[model samples]
Target chain A: MNNEHAEVMEMHMPTEKIVGQTDLYSIKSSTVRTPDAMPRPIRVKAREVNVFYGSKQALFDVSIDVPERAVTAFIGPSGCGKSTFLRCFNRMNDTIEGSKVTGRIELDGADIYDGSIDVVELRARIGMVFQKPNPFPKSIYENVAYGPRIHGLASAKGDLDRIVETSLQKAGLWNEVKDRLHEPGTGLSGGQQQRLCIARAIAVSPEVILMDEPCSALDPIATAKVEELIDELRENYTIVIVTHSMQQAARVSQRTAMFHLGYLVEEGPTDKMFTNPEEKRTQDYITGRFG
Target chain B: MNSLIVATLLLILIGFAYQVGWSRSRQVAPAGGRLHSRPNYHGARVAIWALVPALLILGLWAFFSDAASRAFVMAQLPSDVRAMGGSELAQALSRIEQIATGFGVVGEPAPYESAAGQALREFRNLAFALVVAAAAGTGALGLYLARRRIAPRLRARDEVERVVRYLLIACSVVAILTTIGIVASLLTEALRFFTFVSPIDFFFGTVWNPRFSTVGAGTGEYGLLPLLWGTVMIASIAMLVSLPIGLMTAVYLTQYARPNIRNAVKPVVEVLAGIPTIVYGFFALVTVGPFLAGIGDLVGLDIRATSALTAGIVMGIMIIPFISSLSDDIIRQVPRAMRDGSLGLGATQSETIRRVILPAALPGIVGAFLLAVSRAIGETMIVVLAAGNSPYLRLNPGEPVSTVTVTIVNQLTGDTDFASPQSLVAFALGLTLFLMTLILNVVALFIVRRYREQYE
Candidate 1:
């Protein structure tokens, strides 16, 4: 585990140095994709998506297809628009002032950004976990119960308790927190808090869960546990994660999309993208040589 | 040879010591070797050493000079005059001091008085000169010793820092000592008051009519309950008016308003706090008082022009900024992640605020409320002008009431003898007010600390 963590750290070292060196304007639209032999049904499709903060463009015409019941990881250097694009899925960017998103995002064949669609319901259907563990400063049970209660997913006390239990169980946190469910979720360890956040997102029964660097703030041991939980969650929920660690993407994701300077450089099955990439930039990034 | 001239001379000497030390340190520096501290630190160390001892000597001299002069004057008096009683001795000493300072006595001075005055003047001038010379000599010695110690290995910065730390401690000690001194004086005066009126009667008595009486003729009822009741009633009413409006205003400013609107409106709201309470008193007396009475007449109610409700509503308006501004800052302190987490859970903005943000910010908001309550309780001007001084312990808000602060003002004003219970009772009221505010502040601090620990 330590060896793997060290390798992940080594993979991230070069990326940190390249920040503020890459000019956004010089990057052209270069997307190389490998067609899957056995294609899964798509859960979410974003097309020609462009994001801007005030007048400064953050994501430039980036598009991707997220397949159902599988993990797709967006891997990039810092400030490469991966998290920005992930936030676009849950419409979390709307919370930011003077932020504008121009494009269409479809979930299950309906435009999520359409005027008729309620943002509350759309967010309920698509939940998000932040870079840091953001469990509400509430009891452990209440943290998981927050979503189910707010979305009216549970009708009775028994139902809410059952929901909280199952969600915690699914996040693999039930055994550790069952006796201390009344305690504040913030008092939990970093790994437990992150799992609790995952449990909170799951309690709402979201069809898709968007995680932005979920394990970035966790230790190596906790990172492995969360990675294992992510693999299990992929069997039921369509998962899209934005990670800085390329090793994490290779380990957990079935498909990997690499973003550079606000542009999607290439995307394919994780194995093919890591071992034999079509784009020279993807190869360089994978081998820790690209600036 | 006055102390001011000595102080000015010491200042100049200290400046010269700094320059001398700087040059000495530079001369003592080894070739191609760095000193332990900069030249400025050495200079500052020397300057501090020069100033502190001189200031101490001057302070000691100033403290003892008056007593020494009085002793000398008494010794020089004729034996017959020296046998006078304490009051006569004091009178004789003042007359001699007046003569010495060239302020002539009421009538022609006696031979002994003139002789004593001349002797006192010569003695004072000689003593003053001697103290000044001693202070200057010790200051020069300190400057010379400090300058000799300035070398390449000398830790001048450390020494200077130690002095600076002591200076800071001295300043804080001064502040704490002042508070302790005020409390001690109040306690003594209040105890004196209790001697006239029993503590039980003053504290638990129902009526509060402190009439002036001659010594040993106790005929006043100094009850605390009525004034305390009035203060509580007025404060409750003020809290009732301010809490909801202040909290809502804070919520609107932090959660709902746009950046432009918040920027434009926040200062305007805080401007309410800067308006003098005296002006608010005037508004309560001239505007709110008459307005409420006019409305009462319309509704066939018998509301007095100067009533608890009028003063309370005006005081509430005056403290609106304290609650709103403090609550605004605290609500904003709730991490943005908490809000995002709630909003991501499919909660509406208001639902998120009501369920999460408000609960998370509840402790701090409660602390703000307590602070505003204390402010309301301590408020004097508004209640003085608007709440009529009935001191009847009435239950109705429409009727005029007198709070502890108003009563204290009433008792302290006019030509009243300080030794009388009527005047000394003001000290007891002041002490009670202080303790009440102090307790509220402590509770507020505890809540705020707990809130901080939970979040941070």
Candidate 2:
């Protein structure tokens, strides 16, 4: 059933690439560029994104398209600017002092960096989960309800309650926390706390959820649970995850982009990228020759 | 002889002992075998043993030398001098001791006194010689024993660590004992005051007219109510002025201010703390007092130049850094992750601070406020200069009212006998203030601990 749907998605997506176009896939590396490869519709598109922190350029001109209802994992070593690019989608970099981002990022064809864009509304549309579990120092229920309450997405107490419950249910945390929802979110285990943070992001019902190495702080069992949750969530949400683990990129992502030294090295179907990467650096990174 | 000379000689002796022990430990250890502890541990152990025994003997010698010399001088006095009253005999002895020390006698001494002065000089020399002999002997014995005990398996490090632990415990015990001594002295003096004035009348009486009663005919009212009320009122005003401004300053420094601005502004605000309270007192008495009176006249309200309002406001300014710095540290400690979590959820910075950061930092902020209040309550110079020291029971802050600290200062500094009710009342008030500060600090510590546990 999923194979048939994927075939239909591939047919609907654009198939041809102009030889000299500036689209994400058309920018050829010396080794390879997989144009017209992604099967799903692009939910977010970044063009020539360059980021600087206090005069030091941390990211070169890099761009990628995040597809809808699919996981696009950015894999790289530490300080490789994968996380930096992910933050540009929701304008999270705006919160960092001395950090400057120059380029265009579009969510549903609307320029996110335009002066008319309200950052608060933009963040509501594109949520983020951190590398570490960062549930607020509030009750479990309140942690889940925080987003909906802040954006006034729920008008009534009952609506907020339902939102919290549905968000927790979607994050696979409702059963474990339902009886003790009033307990402090910090009192939970690390894995449970990360799930609570995930539930918090989902409560807003964002169009895209950005996960920055979400399972990096978790044990293997917890990582498996989060990966499973990610697989289930891709049915409804466009997920863009940045991960240091190549295995995690393989297990959870449908399309994978490898970054090196602040540049997007290569991007293609996850299976093809792992099995037959055209870029030497991408193969080197995935095969653990060197990060 | 100078005490510094003795202390220097003792240190030199300990250094020599360390060298001897270090060499001996190296000799005893097999060339190829590993020693249980480093040579320095052995050296330190020997030095500590030598220094401690010598210090004990020196302390004992110093404690008894004066009494030994005085007793010798007293024995040398004639029977007639011995028959004198106790104070007169003491005076004679003091004069003889003064003559011995060549500090010059207050009056002409009799023949017997002159002879006693000579005998006092002899006794002092004998005491000094005996002290030196005993200290040297004890130090030598300690050095010899420690050097002999230095072996490859001596466990010198453990021994030294044990001594270090005891020394640390002794230092803490000294602090605790000093606090206990202070509280005990206060309790005794307060008990004496209560003997003169009943506790019920003192605690519950609204009047605070402590008349100067020398003959104990009728001790005046020593009511604590008015002073307590004044302290509460001034502290409330100080809190009212400080709490919002200080908390806002902390929030701005922690969350809103840029790094360079925060770095620049934080210390500048903390400069308010470094400005001595006396300076604040001067500002209150000379500047704020008159300014308040001018505003009062403009509004047709009678405000004293030196009133609770002026004092409270100035004190609030004085403690602004105390509250702001502590609250800034606490708010900063609320984990960047917590703030990011809220901000990631689309909450604006202020909303995140108000709902997440402040709530997480609430216990710590409460602790900081309590600490500030305790500081405000115990403050003396500002209140002394500006509160006007009027022991009135009125609730009007514009009226001159005295706090506990100010009243204690007023009662203690006046020319009255220490045994009198007025002077003894200072100790009673001091004890009350100390207990209040103690309780507040305890509660603050508890809250801060709980707050730490929450995030950590």
Candidate 3:
């Protein structure tokens, strides 16, 4: 019975390229483009950013620029400081006790770590999704309304209701959950809960969204759905995702930065990085040779 | 023999049996075949077999030997003495028993008493000897059988495990049976109390006076309402004082305080629970009671030194650690991801705690509060000391009041006649208290279970 159900599910799914497929790295190496070819303005810029947890330095003098209206994927092995750097943009590292960040990280020309910058306001502008689907143990409607309610983005109850509806619709979870809006968010399936988290982040109308391996805990079908959502979100929100899966980075990100041992190995368009890379570490990491 | 000697002998025999079985199992192993269980399992199986039969025999002997000796003595007695009424027969048997044990009777005994005492002494020695021999014989037989069964294919380990499981079950049954025994005794005694005072009058009467009177005089009016009201009032005051303070303390410890500060302060706060309730009682009586009375005097309000207010405040102080520690643990149990989810949405730390963490932790906190209320309700020493023992139905916190626990203490202490309504009423009060706490615990468990379902 289970086998038949799985077959039916596979038939209904879109014919997306599976992981480890041969066609994944089929982008021609000859097609290289200069920086002038893509004229999107830089949304966030980092210069020699170093993060330290206690006395141990995690990210060492790493620098990268994220362009507007694009998905920038940070791809590396475990403990490569990709998630650490992702947290730096929204000043999440400040929440960690005894962990200090040095060097400048700017959001749209303003340094977020500056003394005048409010961490709470900066986080509202730059929302984050975590590695695991973590929804509040509240009703689905309450989960979506939490962000806008906290920020007072809605003037009235109707506005809050509208924001919740539009956010869930944007997350592509409104149809499956619209009838059960009063049910607990945690009661949903893992993939649905993840979409609820995305809707919660989107309810605040963030300009930028940072995702730290958002699909790592999901199955393949769920991963595809989230990747599709990331692609859809890129038209309005500047997206930065840290993923362990190189294929996921190649599929979802327009600009990909390769990190190795707390250093930026290479940064360029996804196709160029996958097909022809300037650094051997990037080549070795991408081709399943060595991490 | 005495139980200690029998126990020592049994231990020695078990050790010998274990050694014999271990060596026998090794000898019985086939030339090229492995044993199903190790030598240790065979040895354990033999030891348990040797111990159980002997222990059962010893237990049976300990249970019946005294009665057997008494029956033997009664059988030897002359018809005239045997036909004596209950008290006379009991006295004669005790005198003979004393004589047999070499504590001679005070006056010259009759000829029949002397002869019977001598016969009783001989019978006791024979009975003890017979019991010892039976126990030893059964133990040896069991050891031999167990050793003979220990072959290559024998499942000694499984047998030993089964025995051990039975032993554990027996231990748990002992605990459960003890609680059942206590409840049964309370029910019986409380029923006995109802014979003297009608249940309706005892439950609903407003007057609370129990006078010493003859069997049918009916002088006491054992009303439960006054004490119940006092208990409710005191517990409510305690809850009012402790709930907000304890909850806020938990929030600060879990959400606001630094790790080092939390670690240091948490144990110090918990030390409040470790303080003996009697010490708190003394503090309430000597310090807080007079202080409140002084304050009352300054405000031109009459407050007794020992009043519900004083006792409630002290009991609240005593229960703070219980609420705070339990609540701290519950609030901390809120998943870190939940906190991060709220904080990630640009919510401030306080906002995250107030909206997300607190709501998630609410059921558990409510469970903690209920448990604290039960603790406060059941508290004895503080109430006994500070709550003035005035069995009157009064609403004012400034006046003296008595609680169910305090009345139970009063009714049971100081040469109580157990058959009288004055004393048996304590059992009824205890049963009521037990039921109240039982209901509270069940409610707490229900809330906690519901909370667990949401998370896990």
Candidate 4:
């Protein structure tokens, strides 16, 4: 279902004509076993995705697949529509009043944008954390427990408590915040607040997590903790992260998708995508020829 | 007005003098390395040192002048006029001024008129001398203080910061004191009313008929239950009409409307608030009241044209802008990321608002609604004109009613003596209204605090 018309029409995608080869010295080719090969059965596949806000088309026909239980990173310049396409994955675009998405997005072989889908239930399965921490104006424990309570994950008070505790522990924030469980979530430092948000998203036990520049608002230390958390979360959940920092995408993601304007430039194993890209646009962007 | 002019004048003089002092000091020791504060800060410090004292002196003098000047003129008056008692003495001085100014006396000139005019002229001269001397002494003291530290090492910035801190504190203290004064006045008047009418009777009595006077003159029965009920009914109607519509308009502005439409429509709504309540009152009175009565006649239902419904509906219109404007700001303040976060989790627009946004902004929205409710209750002009001057308690929106503000206005109109129970009733009603609004304001403050603490 991936339409190639948009990829050719978008002028913002950087173009690099390949006149020389032999730069890809370390990319595992067909000659070698690509360490950590992509698993069988993709969990989410987005095809021919074109998005528009009124008359302004933001994303061209972008197509990509997210394999289960691995982190996929979308790397691009500002306003490249990488995040826009990522939002389409969970039907997050539906929240925008006038924003329209015309494409097929299937999650677990079910049409995500189908008329009969329950948006609330879909959201419960695909949670997200934002660039800046957005913990509810409640206690640290309550912040973690909010999603579980809303989704009815816990039936009793003890179950709710245990869920909250486990979520915090998974987010790597329980030890520091255990003493202040009843204290305000916002009273924590920036790094701690980001963890609180992760704990919040995981409380409902979502199968997939979308992060929109999750570490952009944080300091180096906080960014490292979030990156580490992303790596750990990949063991159980599929994660798609939109990042401006190329180094960060390289650090945490097993697969990398490069977008320019609205077009999906290139995507594959992280190492191969970075070292040698089939598309000229991907090469220029990765080699810093132009933004 | 004169004090403002004098403060401005002194401030200018001090500013110029400060510049001169700083420039002269620098000239005496040119290129004094690492001068304390920038040159402007140094100049401001000196200017403040001079102006602050002079302003204080002038303000204190202005406050006391009326009494002090009156004392001076009265003491200097001849013994004959002084002995004529309070009213006579006042009349004599006014007549003397008229004669002296060549307006001529109303009839033949009285014998004491010329002497009175001379005494007044002397009093004016004495006042002028005293004010000038006081101002000069203040300027001198300020100059002496400012001159002592015209050096680079002076902690001029720190000194200025201290002065600014005190100035801000003093301004807020004035606002606090004014509130205290209003509350105290309300409390004292309510206490006086309570002495005549028991609190229990005023609160619970079903019937309201006044039979008040002195015990022998004509003891009046004062019952507040009917008035309270009417006020609450009208307010409830107003809130019911305004709250939902206002909140929806807020949602449209924040969520649905385009930026251009929002910009255009927002000011139009704000203009509704700017149009005085009296104008809305008149619209309710001259237009809506008759319109309702006509509808009532056609429907075969007995409806008073000038009824609580008319006033309450118009009051609701008056408050729509208030609610919409505040709710718009609160909803907009709920953060774009929160919506994105919810949406990214696959929630639709309405679902995101209901589940995440509205809950997050609930305290702020409630705060806005409460503030509008208080505005509806305290409003006077709409009810005074639109609603009939009847205090009977009834639940029907179409029936005649009166609000606390309307009752106060009805009792305290012109030509009535202030000492009568009818007139004093206004103060008692005012006290009750004040307390109600005060409670509402405190609740709004507390709810708004939660909104502020959302991400503290």
Candidate 5:
């Protein structure tokens, strides 16, 4: 029912004015596509998106589509607005003062910026995992139960316990922490803490999960663990991950979006993006020529 | 006068030692040998050595000179004049010394006393000259030894650093020793007071009526319960006003207020701390008291002009800045990641603060509250002038009450008889107040440490 309303809203979306453009000579137009590759139905459509912090622009008119139930990776050098663009999906950028977002971004065909949409509900639907493991200073059980409790998802104590157990199992942390459910979440190791945060986010059963450099602070073993969890999660949830490691992007994502100097240079299937990118900048980034 | 000359001489010797040491180190460095320390350090080490021993001698001589002079003068006095008791002899000696210093005495001194006074002047002069000469000679010896010891192998820098370390340790010990001294003196006097009144009576008696009797009469009711109740009452009221307002102000400054507003307002709030509590005392006495009484009159309640409510409100206003500033720092110290995590979990700002930030900053806020309580308990001027010093046991905030601090002030201010229990009670009250605040601070520290362990 809400999907039809969102579809009509996206069709009636007003055109946004493009700000300062980057001087990349080999930048591809927004309509450019790979040959013999069919387009997937869009779950999130960002059209003519421009973001600014105070007077300085952080993201140019960069448009892309995030397909449902697939892992989409945003890869960029530092301060290239990849994280900024990811924050826009859940309106997390609204928390930053003097940050202005003027664009049309639709989630499940609904305009997320519409006045009728509540931010709390929007954030619950689109959860995020940060670079550093930031579990609440609470018991492991309470950490997983936080979201479900806030959203009133559980009708009773047994239902809440089951939800917590299931969320932890989905995050691959249940077995290690099952006996110590009452211990503080912070008492866990770094990798375990990060997995606990994932469980915390998925506890709400969000449709989309945003991972902002989720594995950047993890070791190789931990990164591998989170990557495997991400792959497993792709069967149920639409995932958007921002990564500094191109190899991890290729390993975990089905689609890869490249951002450079505040511009979305090229985006396509991970196989094509790593093998033969459409833009020179994307190719240079993949080949380690220059950030 | 002789001491001043000796000090000047010691300073000059130190300066000369520094120059000589610097030249010697420079001379050594230019030779085939490497200098072990900088020329400045070599100079400083020599200067310290030269000044310290001489200063020690001077300090010891200054401490004992008067007693030694009097002893010498007394020994030369006639046996009949020295036959008097210790106190009487000391009094006669002071009178004689005053006459010798050209301050006129009440009556003519006896022939023996006049002779002793002349002897005293001569002995004092001799003693002063000996002390100055010895101190100067020691400084000269130290200077020569330090200069001779300065060589390529001399660890001047290391020696100087060691001296500095000792100096810093000595300075820190000074504070600890002073606290020990204060506690010791209070303990002794309180023990003396307990001899006059039983500890059980003082602690358990409900009535607080100190009769102001003579030293041995021991005819006063020194009950602590009423004063303790009053202190707790006022402190509770102060906390009731300060905790919520201070915490909210801190939250606003940290989470909600703009940078410009925070910058403008934080110092203004802190300025309340700088205002003399006496001024707040006047405000409570003149303004708040009358205002409350006026309101009470309108409501047909009997509220005195100088009631506990008035003093507590003013004290609470005084402590708001303390709570606000400390809690602000503690709340601000909470990692931004904590807030981000809560916000990302779809919590509103208030919800995040209530559920996460406040819980994280709880121990620190509790510490701040305890600090405010201690301040409220120890506050003298505000309670002295504002709390009407009624000394009556009452639970009503509308009535005037007396706190321990106000009673201590009342006992010690004027016409005090130190030997009597009335004046002596002040020390006992001080000791009790100190112990109470100490326990409060310890509890606060314990909570704060436990809280810190959770986050860090």
Candidate 6:
């Protein structure tokens, strides 16, 4: 290998040491042209984000920018903080009584943790689908309609019906359960139940959709179906997904972030990151050197 | 008695035969091929075959012998007494039973007396003969069947399974028969009560005065309205006091409390539930009742020491653990994934609880509430002491109010004539209590069904 390629492969761990030493001129230049080259508006920005759960600190200062109308993927090994950073996007760590998060997070230029913001309203703007399919014991129609009704997104019965139909259509589940919308959501197969949860999240028309290992519980065919839906979802909403499958992240995301032991080891364009990573850890991880 | 013992001996003999047969079969079958089931199973199978039919026949013969044996023995009496009314005949027949069983007879043992003694002697001998014959007949039949089925394809296991199924059905029938018997007796007495007090007067008359003046002219008006009102008021107060505290405590313990705190607090709180209602009764009567009466005096209000408030409060305290435990389980089962899903949506902790946890648990909560209501209504000891004997119709929770259960106790703990309105009133109150509790239980069952539908 050439000296340049070898150097790029080994640049990640020491990148943190250089973070404090980076001159003012270097950071400004590095962050400047990326936004313009990007295809969509910048929707969310994170800088120096660190998280700790009880006595164990999980994420190092991780910075990433999520662009609107595109998919961003977080790929890493177990305990690598990929899902932890994904949770930070939604402030889900708040539920863990002793979890502590410190950083700057801006959604459309407003601090998400600002006293002016309502978490409910913010969550309405940011929907979520879990790793496992979790639909309320209610019917498919009611499951999809719950968010809309709770948030008053649909004020009339006709509006609610349209919302349910359109949400299910968006989730690629309208065909299988269109006739049995009144049937229990749990009565459906595992894959179909996951799709119903997606429909439920979409009923309120969220601006960003965060998925944590969304397809880990799915079979290959169901995973493929969700991948196709993610591609389409990027047309209207920013998508950030945490995944263990490198191929899934490669197939769905435009930008990929690699984490290791709570550090953002690498972040770059997916094609470049896969074929020619700027960091050795990222290269070793994607090539299965070590988990 | 001698023949019953002979029948019992025959039963044991056949049972021993079956056990020996099974052990021999097990030992022999395994030499050529393994036995079809465990050795114990085969032994039990044989014992069942020997005992079941013999016991059924003996029981049937014993039950059917009551009237005919009496008639047969009486037929040997003098002509006038032989045709006596059922009561007189029964009296004479008892004399025969006493003389037969050797309970020393009296009254000079009149004309038919010797005939009755001889008749009793004959009937005893016949019953002994009949019982022994039936047991021997059934046992011989079972032995013959077992011997005929000596082939390898006898499939004793299948026969045993059938027997087991029938036994299970019989056991369930016993339970069902007991419930039906209770309902029938309650209904009969309740019908007798309705003959005196019209349903409307019993339901809505607002007075519960029962006249027990032995004079025939005493016609007391007994109405259920006061007792019904008292029951409702006390139950409502109990529910109001228990619902929020129990539910919130459950939520706190399950969702927010640290492990150490939860472990320490839960058993202490449940200790309240384990206390006997009777203990709570005296506590309410001795402590809360007098304390409240004192508070009432200070406020320039007239309140009895034993009042609805004391009982209701005590009942509420007793039921908190029930509500808390049930709601805790329901909340815990709300699917960790659901909580995760809500949190992942950027919903705050309280927001997620209010929207997801509470909604998911609503059906279960309703079920818990309904069960609590039934428990409160049926509660007796706590109310009997703290709630006074007064059955006056009034809405003041501080005033002494008697519930239906208290009235039932008051009217039934004596040797009064059963025909009196006061004595029969207990059965009437019991029937009303039964119907009310039945409705509450049914409603609670429906709520549980609805709650289960969400998960299933």
Per-residue CA lDDT of candidate 4, range A167-228, in tens? Answer: 99999999999999999887898889989999989888999998889999899988888888
Query: In candidate 4 chain A, what residue range of length 10 has the lowest lDDT sum?
Result: A26-35
Is candidate 1 or 6 superior in DockQ?
A: 1
**Residue B227 error for model 1, in Å?**
0.7
lDDT of each: 0.88, 0.87, 0.89, 0.79, 0.86, 0.81
What is the C-alpha lDDT profile of model 3 across B161-204, one tens digit per residue? 99999999999999999999999999999999999888999889
Q: Please, what are the lDDT tens digits per residue for candidate 5 over residues B258-311?
A: 888999999999999999999999999999999999999999999999989998
Which of 1 and 4 is the better model by TM-score? 1
Query: Per-residue alpha-carbon lDDT of model 6 for B113-167, expressed as tens digits?
Result: 7667777777878876877677767866776566445444456677778999998
Give chain B TM-scores in order: 0.96, 0.97, 0.95, 0.88, 0.95, 0.88
Q: State the DockQ of every prediction.
A: 0.63, 0.61, 0.63, 0.42, 0.50, 0.36
Q: Over 4 Å off in model 1, which ranges? A: A1-37, B1-4, B86-88, B103-115, B214-217
Tell me the TM-score of model 1.
0.92
Which digits, one per residue and each the tens of the lDDT, describe model 2 over residues A1-291? 245434533443333422222222222232132323547888999999999999998888787898898889999889999999998888888888999999889999989999999989988989899999988888999899888988989989999999999999999999999999999998998899999999999999998999999999999899888988998898899999999987777777889998877888889888778777776666656756556
User: Which tens-of-lDDT digit does each residue in A193-269 have in candidate 1?
Assistant: 99999999999999999999999999999998999899889879999999988778877888999987677878888
Query: What is residue A200's positional error in candidate 1, in angstroms?
Result: 0.4
lDDT for predicted candidate 1 compared with the true structure: 0.88
Give fnat, all candidates: 0.69, 0.73, 0.71, 0.64, 0.51, 0.60
The alpha-carbon RMSD over the true interface for every model, in angstroms, is 0.8, 0.8, 0.6, 2.9, 1.0, 2.6
lDDT of 5 by residue, A129-193 (tens): 99899988889999899888888999999999999999999999999999999999989989999
| Per-residue error (Å), model 1, residue B316 | 1.2
Query: Could you give candidate 3's per-residue lDDT for residues A1-291 as a string of tens digits?
Result: 245434533444434423333455653222222222566899999999999999999888888999998889999889888999999999888788889999999999999989999989999999999999999988999999999998999999899999999999999999999999999898998888899999999999999999999999999899989988998898799999999988888878889999876777789988788877776567667766555
